[model samples]
Target: MNDVVNLAEKLAQFSEHWSPRVVAELNDYQLKVVKLQNSFVWHKHDDTDELFLVLQGAMSIRLRDGDVSLQAGELYVVPRGVEHQPYAEDECHVLLIEPRGVVNTGDAEDTRLRADNDRWI
Candidate 1:
């Protein structure tokens, strides 16, 4: 069986904003897909690095040090234990890379936990 996935097709399967879906896994890491708009809570993953890749639309990562903007075809990594928030003016599709068990809202838990690691595709 083929282990690879078509990113475009995977993204097309969901339309929920801020909810993440699992696309693939590697060792202890996972590849997740999420649609974002508006602002996310400020938080940090104390033990894992977070990666964001813009698949469609635009957004920005607000960090304690500064903010980074991303357009389609762009990507950025938020190192472990860094305080940051993600925001988007309009609908945006993105991919996240992080170790398994990493929560979407980091340590600050709330209603934002749309799906857990096990629910990912």
Candidate 2:
């Protein structure tokens, strides 16, 4: 029999900071969970839009035009081709919904690239 996986349980298994783990999949899209602090690299997905849903804590998105702050239960959509950076003062849990093959770092090829792809908890 298949076991049911709860997101809260899956998130509990991860302790690494700033790394995103795959949690589920819907069609060609992937659902990811990540804990974040400080700031992420400035990048943009030239092909697909990215969605960020705050599960806990708070986050801020820095864009070329301005920045947006997100609290718990808040969500933001970064359109394709728009450069942005994410940051948080305290640790934050977020759910990211995006298309398959979309890199977490976008066009950036830094050490922060999360190699795990499309993995489901």
Candidate 3:
């Protein structure tokens, strides 16, 4: 059976920053929603590319070459094996798509910021 997912309402259920909530699943990939603020650690995914879509506010992905800023409704794809860090000055809503079991902090582990997988909203 299939069901519709309301992103906004789903987002309303959680408020912790940097912690992503599983909203939906598509095959092997999981669609997760997160609220970002401040800075994230520099890390790289060795196996899979990650898609970051800004649902609201603003965000920037800092790479070795340059930093890419994304506003509401914008999106960016961080290719696999590329080290990058994400930051936001204010509350930013984001939707991330990556294969199931992908760690939130990538190769860099931050016990304070690491979120458990398969947590549904």
Location of the lowest summed lDDT over 10 successive residues in candidate 3: 109-118
Relative to the true structure, how large is the alpha-carbon lDDT of every model?
0.86, 0.85, 0.93
Candidate 3 per-residue lDDT over residues 1-121, each given as its tens digit: 1879989999999889989999988999999999999999999999999999999999999999999999999999999999999999999999999999999889997667888988888
User: 9-115, model 2: which lDDT tens digit per residue?
Assistant: 88899787667787777788888898888989898999999999999999999999999999999999999999999999999999999998777888876756454
- Model 3's number of clashes is 0
Estimate the TM-score for candidate 2: 0.90
TM-score per candidate, chains pooled: 0.90, 0.90, 0.96
- Tell me, by lDDT, which candidate is best: 3
| Model 1: colliding residue pairs | none
Higher-ranked by lDDT: 2 or 3:
3
Off by over 4 Å in 3: none
Ranking by lDDT: 3, 1, 2
Off by over 4 Å in 2: 1-4
> Candidate 1 residues 19-48, lDDT tens each?
888888889888888889899888888998
